[model samples]
Target: MMNIMRNSKHPVRTAAKEASHERIVSAAARAIRRSGYDGTGVADIMKEAGLTHGAFYAHFASREAMLAEAAERACTESAAIAAEAAASVPREQALTYMLHAYLSRENLEQVERGCPLAALGSETARQTPEVRRANTRYIKEMVDLVARQSPDWGQAGAHERALVTVATMVGTLLLARVVDEPALSDSLREAALKHLPIA
Candidate 1:
């Protein structure tokens, strides 16, 4: 039955389905970041992608499946920014540049376009295993990327420090986003920059 369905799909139909799936995943990524995984709904995602609610099942088996894909998509973009920053700057200053970018006021305000680790970290505790697994993998990817760029890459405690750096950055942003006052928010970000090992 599976083979029959695969063989019956025309090339054009396959391409169109792939395109729709991409659209749904992209929309879910942004929506989940902005509104959260629990807050985002299939109806809203489909509508945001300019498709009907009924079309969701055609693209995804379940909400959790879509959430897993969305988490992976968001985390991939987050990792890319860190990796690129690490590559672009001088070895000694690579982490500094990445830290500055990660803790920037602009990044803090642009949650929908920013790191999934910060945006969805707390929420993932209540998520499915697949979603949690994807988040964990991407987080490790970001940590490894930063660790490799460290001056003491292979030395003892280098990876631990890298993990702390990533955690501090993400935690600071998450705290900054939750505060009611703008002053407190700015202070949180500044404190993270001042105290974090971004030298």
Candidate 2:
């Protein structure tokens, strides 16, 4: 079957258009990562993406649509690893990688485009119901992926773990970026990872 949605009024994601759209979405993701959804404006996203403001409408109906896509994209980025990270280690180690990746200084510094949780959690709370649902599904999937390691764990177990992981990461990154000192930033990473593999 064909992807009718892919070929909607939106231009084709051909070799040419694909790169630009990817750039726009990735740029917007990065902006949201750095500036927060409300903080990052369309023009700023476009400029950061290296495209002009006029081109954004062609890719998305509005910023929410972009955020929706960004949320999906961010989840997609983490989903693959969620499985792989858990494969070799016990459930907790996998959790460490998943949570660690999100809360690290490397992630906070990148901003503009990193973990969706750190980049857009608050904004997502304010999003349209549809977007919120999408985010919910993404979070559930990630939780399930981690819970897989504990064959005995139930849905509630997975759900709570996922919530803790996502919350830990988001809060850590938020505080990490807020501080002016490098040690403070490293301290946040250490604090978040304290319960994970290293500690």
Candidate 3:
């Protein structure tokens, strides 16, 4: 009877722990995007999650583990946003709608809540293998998402076109963020939008 009673409490404890773990990951995801991987610290993430620093170990094996999960979360969020943008319009206009959303003024200013590829791509090369793997999955997923939007999806060159499209979008956004001049930034985005091979 005692053992049964004790075991019953395990589920409640596990649920609480899972909730805390989610909070940590969510906070870490935002922090990484807002501050970049090298700029984010475990202590800051824990504080952002409203937990004590010492409690971090209870949720993750190491800082790298937390970072890896955070990277995955950020990627998942960006992908969802892209999917939502694509879905908001008619099927024929999905790609254009998604492209506009990706390069919009709102996305340009909302780095913390925008695409991880544009915000973290430069820094990802220096990150740990685990973090890199998380980002790689996102890149693949984003490419697939773009390819599916192609009118010639499943054709020979569709995947290649998606590669170019994703690259162009990411590159355009990255450059737009780099320049301090607002006019130049707008021009860069405008050029990409005007020239992107939309079908």
Compose the digit string of candidate 2's lDDT tens values, residues 20-137: 8898877765566667667868888788788999999988898888877776776676566556656756655666666666666666777655556656657778877766786787
Deviation in Å, model 2, residue 46 alpha carbon: 3.0
**In model 3, which residue pairs have backbone atoms overlapping below 3 Å?**
none
Whole-model Cα lDDT of every candidate shown, in order: 0.87, 0.69, 0.91
lDDT of 3 by residue, 110-155 (tens): 9988888899868999889988888888889888888998889988
lDDT of 3: 0.91
Residue-wise lDDT of candidate 1 within 74-116, one digit each (tens)?
8888888788888898888888888889889889888988998
Model 1 alpha-carbon miss at residue 120, Å: 2.0
Q: Which predicted model would earn the best TM-score?
A: 3
- Model 1 CA deviation exceeding 4 Å by range: 1-9
Tell me model 1's lDDT, rounded to 2 decimals.
Answer: 0.87
Candidate 2, run of 10 with poorest lDDT? 143-152
Better of 1 and 2 by TM-score: 1
> How many clashing pairs in candidate 2?
4
- Ranked by lDDT, the better of candidates 1 and 3 is 3
lDDT of 3 at 65: 90
Candidate 2 lDDT? 0.69
